[model samples]
Target: MALNSKDTAETLILLLNRSGQGDRAAFAALYQATSAKLFGLALRILHRRDLAEEAIQDVYVKIWHHAPSYRADKAAVMTWMTTITRNRCLDLLRSLPPEHGLNEEQSFDEWASDDLGPLEKATSNSEARALLQCMKQLAPLQRQAIALSYFQGMAHEQLARQLVQPIGTVKTWIRRGLQVLRSCMGAL
Candidate 1:
């Protein structure tokens, strides 16, 4: 890893250690340093902005409770944080009914305000930017279907109902979109 990456990891470790001791300022600093990336990850997993926000909030709560158990020898601080966030998102997805669909009228701007600020976008790691670029290469409908299924954890039937498309069509869109994304990402 680069020197800067090492420094960042060390800083996160220090923050985690302080947070484990119940240092509010350190915990706050940790959130400030990591929330944007974690939020983006949650949003990618749970397409609904509201749900993503909730997931990140829950993730931080878990971090607060579990920070003392973190083992740097097992994984880097960011890896541990990401694992927690990802697991939280998966748990949330599993808890929701497969038929649940997001409200179509909820504006993206509302959910993206804090998560995608200028600095956050500018600071996003290259891998995230590349994945986003690959996502952009998808057809509009394909991308929508994929996002609904993967992020929102919607079933094919649910997506069909929300999109006014047949279940088969929704499945096809998701399959093709994912294939394209895989190819694009692999090429990077």
Candidate 2:
């Protein structure tokens, strides 16, 4: 029988709770169930298979370490995991040389295929589209600053260095961009 999104989410929560208690079997099951989707997310962000794989490993390690602290109220289990994976990939990206990191772009269409199940994909696609639309509404520099800070997980100093702007200017751009995004998303 197939599980719906609620069922799947419930199962993941159970597994996460068990994993929090150091249940190896539950952790393994969670890994088996979610790794592909998480890997796809990492690959989308980093645009490299090897780096994505490394990010997945690092993400899982952090997940294992941090499981006991999981709060269902804070975010859904999958959302939390995806956040960790994305951040790991961004960290990897930051560590790379600028020439290799900023210049690479691979087709994400192939990376997403069959990785996220149907319902998950549908939900993700809608959310991604909404975010893209809101991003497009920003001024070019504000959009760029926000993307680098949030999507790429760059610090203000890093963004300043990369964009050749002052740190305060980078911070202002990110702050104003986020405020605009919040207003835009709130209207949706």
Candidate 3:
């Protein structure tokens, strides 16, 4: 890993550790460092500025409460934080009715995808390239589910509604899709 990224990662880990010990300043720093990325992820999944904003607020609350339980051995800091945000967004989506699907005025593809041919230069990172490769190999639904959840910070509820599929089905796609990605990447 590059020194800069490694430093950032280490810093995040330290912040998380301090937050777990009830250090408010460290938690504040953690929020400041990660909020923008988390907000963008929430925006992508929720597709509504208001809801995205609300979700981030709720996500931070959860993070504050759950920080003590975070185990770095289980997942990276970003992955853990993203999962919380995605789940909260999905919960919000589930409470809404089916007719509340994507608004025609808000073309998700227009803003959600910047189309740098997928902005997929793979970040000049080997892991990103490997992940992109594994992602492409997925079944369309599976791939979409993973991308929406991991890449776009989508929770399953909105993802199901967006894909026009049942919630259970969408969850299955994400679960199975993750298995494939893990297996494929493990080979690298």
Candidate 4:
């Protein structure tokens, strides 16, 4: 049977719960369902195929261990997993050596994009599409600020310096942009 959003979330919850009990099959199923989206998110932030691969692997190991702690009321499965992936990528990026390609001068170009290519590949869910739609409506700078802060994991001070704007301005852009997103999302 085809699964709606509710059904899909329920299945994921079941899989997570089972995996917490050390069910390898359910864990495998969960990984199969989520790894692409999670990997895409990692790749977007890390900007290296190898690092993204490493991050995905590490995130799943944590997921396998923390599956029991997942509280459905706190977040949906995808949101929870995405949080873990984002955090892991940030951690990996932070610990990278100067020999690695990462540096303070790295461009904010990736975060500034509204391309739905990654999202399209990740999921065709209505909510995902709606978010993309809302994101499209944001001013480019607002999008850039939000993306850099969220995905690239830059602090307000860092973003201000990187963008050559005042710190308050950077914070304002992010706050206002998030407001717009929340309003737009609620409307949808």
Q: Across residues 1-188, which tens digit of lDDT does each residue of candidate 4 receive? A: 22238988899999999999899999999998888888888987888999999999999999999998888788888888999999999998778874654465556554465575664465567776778778877877777777777777889987887788999988888888889998999987
RMSD of 2: 6.1
lDDT of 2 by residue, 1-188 (tens): 22226788899999998999999999999999999788877876787789888889999999999999998778888889988887788878878887664542432222223332332444444555676667666666776666566556778888788778899998888888889889999999
- Give one digit per residue, the lDDT tens place, for model 3 in 22-83: 99999999998899788877876677799889999999999999999998788888878978
Tens-digit lDDT string for candidate 1 (16-71):
98999999899999999999888987876777799999999999999999988888
Q: Between candidates 2 and 4, which one is better according to TM-score?
A: 4
Clashing pairs in 4: none
Clashes of 3: 0
TM-scores of the candidates in the order shown? 0.59, 0.68, 0.70, 0.83
Kindly give the stretch of ten consecutive residues in candidate 4 with the minimal lDDT sum: 101-110
Off by over 4 Å in 2: 1-7, 97-99, 104-125, 157-169
lDDT of 2 at 93: 85
- In candidate 4, stretches whose alpha carbon ends up further than 4 angstroms from where it belongs are 1-4, 98-123
